[model samples]
Target chain A: MSEITLGARRPVIVRRRRWRIPGAAIPYLFLAPATLWYAAFLVYPMLQSLYVSFFDWDGLSPSMTFVGLENYINIFAVDDVARLALWNNILWTLGALVLPTLFGLLLALALNRRAPASTLFRTIFYSPAVLPLVAVGLIWAWMYNPHFGVVNVTLKAVGLRSWANGWLSDYTMALPATFVTFIWSHVGFPMIFYLAGLQAISKEYYEAATIDGANAFQRFRHVTMPGLAETHVIVLSLAVINGFKVFDLVYTMTYGGPGRSTQVLGTWMYFQTFQYYHAGYGSALAWVIAAIVLVIAIPYIRRMSRG
Target chain B: MMSDVRRQRRLEQTVIFLGLLALSLIWLTPFATVVLSAIRGQGDLLARGVFSLPKKIAWGNFAEAWSTGDFSIYFRNSLLLIAMKVPLGIFIAALAAYPLAKLRFRFSGAIFIFFLAGLAVPVQVTLQPLLVMMKQLGIANSLFALVPPYVAFGLPFQIFVLRGFFRLIPSELLEAARLDGASEWTAFLRVMLPLSVPALATLCIIDVLATWNEFLIALVLISAKESRTVPVGLLQFQGEYSSQYTLLMAGILISIVPVIAIFIFLQRYFVAGLTAGAVKG
Candidate 1:
């Protein structure tokens, strides 16, 4: 009887102890480092940046005069460079949505068959995506060189010399030219993503579609497209976010050059803050970008959390 | 009719093969340009054009680039950054994730959401303020300036991965450890961590690769000559060797070889890590 009583009481004692604040300290202890880190580097700085957006100050100034969203109004109303950048970003977003996804899906479908050479081809195609943007930007820059670039040389050799122009230097051509390189590097990522999605698809779907007298194109359109909708969400959402935040590639390739024709919000933000010393204006631009990305990203993240 | 169908199918296969081959060739052009240009003599590259075959392979361009290209320092710096950042960041994230995944804590849901929000915030949004903060911290030009931010940025994803993995682990094992009179901490250290090798490995691969090729943070924070990483070094090398195609190509080759070799050797880890969330890991 005494032993039974002791055993029953033991759990209550432990539970009571565990429920106390001191006993619950372990989880908090575990969480502390990450908490401290986020508060210091991520959260605090973000809030600080938002505060700075309302001021009129160079980065080094000893004083900041509060301007009350004047910088935001200024960019929206007066800044042609920002307007141009917004336009280019829209173009980029459209291109990013269509071109890379189309090519990636096509490549993935073609390579989904178990051909012996398919693995090698997949690796080769995926190689460009693995390379540093700095290296990719430079190689394309060199390829677009005017005097003796391979692009021009090949054009001349093919008897279409008139088709060749200085690819990077021409204002109208520069962004598109940069976009071509962007696609070259980018398509492989979505290809890999789609390939993974394709492989997960059970063979029964295709077989059933075939039995229903669906041709290859019809099967692909109806079955494959809906099957990979999750991957489509992941790819398209990421593509849009990356589109808004593009910087390193453009910076390395052209530095928004030959004019500001190729400038996107990212480079323009850098130009405003670092080059022009308008830290206030730049911070406002950053806030706008953050808002746009969050508008797209939060829903996806919430959906992911639900799963 | 069956023989005709077979023949048509074979012809279609041939067409597919030719199409893939053409696309593959187009994909390889930039790599081919970089490799071929790296081997040609600089004078020949300048005079005869980039398309011209080299008189002899200038294999020594790599040697010259290593000594003069500042890549040696940059390479070491990148190596050092990853070495310090990856393991430390993963450790912190893993520790934090354990309680969130296993233990009942107040506000854990809210905390997870906060971390997830970090994913949406662009680096540019924080760039200006971060610069000033680093300056105030008096670590602006040093490698230390990068560590907190890198660790902080990497945490959300890492915690998300680890917590999900931890949740997938059968709770009975942890319960058994607790019933065996082990402390929760010991259960975590021994049972949870040992069982988490694959997830941890996936995180390491992703984190290391990101740090190795990280451009923006290194560009913004570390401007000291000795503190630069491979990407920044390559960018600067471009300015100096803008006319020297062979040398520039050599520099590019040197910078990318380590990462490409790593990817090839650990291709499965890379592909798996990159697609972890999209597919069920």
Candidate 2:
């Protein structure tokens, strides 16, 4: 008993046999609380939701009836909102990928140099990113206010009276208007990331490019874009993820309304589960979101793991 | 010819400056609008447009937003949630990160990847069952119900950042601690944590902002007014004062002041903290 061998038949020193916890187990000990917490709070809930996805139950009910893949099937076959939501998510992802990434790069390029007030300009651009999205939604809602908002007020001042409209309530303008608000809040995200990426690009690359008779555009094309490749992957991935996870702005501003025109998956899931009381269907949407995210995030995760 | 180049450079600089100024003014316009609207009373705001200056400074709008908006309670609840969740989350994440960063283990890579995978798991995926679980525990309405899920959801990022930082601490320093008869726990507490302050500080900043800004989970789980967080509280403020434009603006202003102050002071830390566990790790 004093001298013991582990499972592999390798003789191991067991100085504290009563404790039975070996050095190998020490790391596990350190990891125990976190692992337990994840298993209980994170993993178990995930599995529970997975189970709930197969059922027909209001979230508050006493008992759940197992309905197999009916909810998943219904999402495709009958749920027009689901299809519209999926389409909207793709639109949001495309919009985010284009607008913010492009504008952010331009801003980063401008502010990358150490000119006077550059930092001040940078601060101004990125400041909106720090505010809560709920606040952002509210701010822009007021900004888009039909009667007394600044958008219309300024338009009227500029003699563009015909352009002033209830942007959020208009069926065609609602989603795009919300997207403009998104651009206002989200451009800073890509700006900061690209800024960091730009800072990391070595001056040697530029020097060599200049020596090779590369003009400004040529040097940027050959050097800067290539340098920011990893950052692009990361930034674009995040933009897509943010698109899938679009909730706060949509919820607080248009609230998937003017008759669900703004209903992305996030808001749609909330409507399904909480409002419509379709717990199982909502869980299915949740899983679908997870699946889509994982598809984008796997490569990102692999990229991160190398570090 | 040299003078021409200098003059050309000066002209280019002027154009760049003007462009930047235009963008800055455009960006600042939203905030300027809010400020203008905040200081004006209801009559003043409705009488004048949002873009106009305050005719009568209703500084009491802030006080009314604070009391009537119930932002005082919201602020307290948010602070309490942060206080409880941040420390507990950081400590637990740090503990796990210590082993994953410095120790030899069979499942280290797999475990790390597993945690990293959690990063991609959207809060929506777990919201339903988490709410059900919270209800079963009978803490669904309590602020305490928030702590577990907050800490849980925060783990993957927290651990990712902390582990990346912990790995950067010289291994020789840890070896020195080991030689000096310090146990793993002692080495972690004394050597690892102290050396990881920059990482911890960044994590603290990140955690505060995230917890403060989080909306949907709080929107779903918290139905009670007293237990409401800042984001939800702001939504309530919006609903109640939808027409009371000045008061709503004041409430929005009050909610953002703390984070904006943090940003202005710690802008460097903010960027560093935000990009901490990103691909560059």
Candidate 3:
């Protein structure tokens, strides 16, 4: 009887031990599919791009020669188009940081108060966000047409006809014109974000401020802005990252047009890889862009995680 | 004292109302112009200013743009892409997120960091190699060409957001399920999934918007006219009607209606989803 009981307990213990091994491995089991997909499609290609960046492969003919950083050097040395595109990217990043943040705050403040049709006002303000970049670009392209465009027509009607050139075609106006469309398309997202953040703040803060006889601006400065620090960081980082990656609008609207005056890093990389077939050089440019985003984002990530 | 405060609040409210009214008009004008231009008769479109009230409503313009631009076919293709991509992406993301959110395993954090790295790399870097891979697979110009890459690109962010929501679930419920002899899979399905409907709905709405609006991947993958999505179709319309503002506006209007309709119907989910990711992270 004693041996029978002992044998049964031994099997149970063995079964428990066996289960522990796989139980500890369960997370990997769940993560395997996604990791596999990422490895094959993302990590593999990234490494491949880096490897190919050292070669002079034109994307097709199988004969590859080792170029040994020639592609990177050449891209940096003689690429005026790249320089212009980078400048546009910087301008975009700056504009995205400032304009959307300000507009979103203003919109949030206006809608923060209880009012009739506030929901309608919020919806109207945010409608542009739901439209795809391609659609926005196409619509705005029509609106930017020098002759029949609403912009020029409105300018003419207002007796400011000389101020209106082909908004997207003129070399000087093209980039800023495109930036305006970008701003319009994106401002709604941060507005909604800021609104949610505002609502999350306790009413007691405001009440306390009022009791202290704080003015509106003073309350905003001391209460509202401080309360929105997390939101501010998220918005700023997302805006910067998105600014760096903007391509579709530029592609559909300008196609790096009017002598490549409106080209940004994203569009430039597209042209280099797809059109020009300088896959090696394009990869180098892509790495540069990624490095820029990382430099800006890593500190924020650390700050967020710490909080 | 109370009356003065009330009056001051009323005055402030009026100021806010007027300011919002002006801002809303400025914000809405571009959309209004698109709709008006699309509805205006060709004669009215050409003669009157772009913002003028239409002399006659050209309801036929929407029909014409739909039929002439082959927008119906494009719409179907776009729907198919979204239908396939969103579910598949979400399923993979959910499966991937479950373990990361629930289980304690070695390298879980490292694996997550790998996905975090993916969020920073723009789509352009991956495009060239993806094109090469598609060609190697010999489906370079087909609808299948678009799906794999879309899912690949979408997984990281989807997993990120879903994992955040999943992590917030109480661990005690999961342990109770385990005590009740439920397998991990069963526990996830029966316990976690029902509780996660809101988060899943948010994910679905966002994925729909992103997939439906995706253009760069569609441009690179789908070359045939019939397989092109709405954005590609709209691009073609722009190319073909380079000079005809009215027809172009008509095409733009047609392209936007589906998006606007979906957004309006799912506005709550859309706002919640956007705010969820933005506010939390």
Candidate 4:
């Protein structure tokens, strides 16, 4: 165990004749396949992405110029869409934080008491959350269609014809229109969390609050809010992370725009890398996404590892 | 006084019922649009209105979308990917989970933490380099190229759940098996996996949904028409048939129906697995 003989002289190999393989190596053997996949696909590419970010390389050719910090500087100083995408991500995070959190809690509150046909109502409220984002996005896209869309059709039927603008085409409306679809599909997520959080709250707390002469709102504020604090953390953190990760919905719905007005970091990165052949700039964008996700996700990861 | 109380209760119930009904209808409008849009002719839709009842139900849209939209190939490829990917991912995860959960090793804690860090790394970050690697390896557009990335991305979550389930299993069972001359692999195969079936099933369902709907990686790594999964295939369909609204809606429904049906029937599993976050300190 001496530092001088740390490796070569201190072999602790078990010399049992009955053993074919060393006992100490079994876990590593068990770990080999998953580790290999992660190393090859996830870890290697992750480091490679960082390396590739320092260069001006179209993903196609054999030549790449090492353009030190030009790509990173371009993102911060030069790229208009990059700034817009950053603002869009912040807007998306705020929207995700507010709308889904509020509506999901409301749905959880309304259905928490298990009234008549409550299960069916729960199913209805949650169904949109379960579908593929592409399907969900297209469904909303159809509803938002300028000419024959149901939103315009419904408005026209009600004789508010002028109010029926092209919901997905208008610059101001397009981002919010896509956000509405995000809310529709995602509100159920936080609802399920709140519903579980509500169930986990001991009934005795409510009884005690009632005995203290509290009204429903007071009891909700004092008891229910504190009880669901952990759920709130889980929901808000995940919503923020998914906010950064948002691609499928925006990609499917608006493809980041009528004129890049709907661009988020994810779809912007996609277009830059694949569509425009700006691999270096796109890698920088991807790293930005990774950086944001890591900051939000570290606590969740640490908590998971403690198990 | 009793009669008054009963009247109040009945009135409250009625109000609740009506409120629920209104909410359900609002929540269900998009689905209603899809259902109606899927059943009508293009002319009928544009002529009558978006919400109009079909004068004659066109059952042909599903047939046309299935065949003409190339959705048949997409569905087959998606299902094949799911069948191939989920079991292999879970098996590898279970193997990795067993030692991380049970065996006391020098670096178990560090290794576990390293794997947890993978959870925070976005798949988008891995795409460009993985695409390059795949191209260099000459397997870029093949359906099987997705297997490695999907499995790698799935591992952190899968191992987290399976290891949580495994840790809850009494260590004495493994000790007893070892005393009976069972090797570590035997102890794992015979003692650990069978007890973790519930966790494994939940992982299966979660991975199935993820793999089916996964788009960006598949979109980036896969370019061949024959290898396109459901999500990408439908996107291509939308571009090709921008005017065929009915057919596109039909295509959307056809893609989602199976998973929706599974969700309805297995509602409990979906809730339990999805909400199994690591909030516990």
Instruction: State the TM-score of the second chain for every model.
Output: 0.92, 0.95, 0.95, 0.92
DockQ of 3: 0.45
lDDT per residue as tens, model 4, B165-185: 898899999998777776788
Ranking by DockQ: 2, 1, 4, 3
- Proportion of the native interface contacts kept in model 4: 0.70
What is the per-residue lDDT of model 2 for residues A1-307, given as tens digits with 9 covering 90 to 100? 5332342253222222344456888999999999999888888988888899999989987898999999889887899989888988999999999999999998898889877799898899999998999999999999999998889988999999999999999888889999999999989988988988898899999999999999889999999999998999889988988889899999999999889888999999999999999999999998889889989998878877768
lDDT of 1 at A298: 74
lDDT comparing candidate 2 with the true structure:
0.88
lDDT of 4 by residue, A140-220 (tens): 999999888988888888999999988888899998999999988888889888888888898999999999999889999
When sorted by lDDT, best at the front, the candidate numbers are 2, 4, 1, 3
Report lDDT (Cα) of residue A42, candidate 3: 77
Worst 10 residues of 2 chain A by lDDT: A7-16
Q: What is every candidate's C-alpha DockQ against the true complex, given to 2 decimals?
A: 0.49, 0.51, 0.45, 0.48
Ten-residue stretch with the least lDDT total in model 3 chain B: B272-281
i-RMS for every candidate (Å) is 3.6, 3.6, 3.7, 4.2
Candidate 2: segments with Cα more than 4 A from true spot: A1-21, B1-9, B277-281
Which candidate comes out best when scored by TM-score?
Answer: 2
Of 1 and 2, which scores higher on TM-score? 2
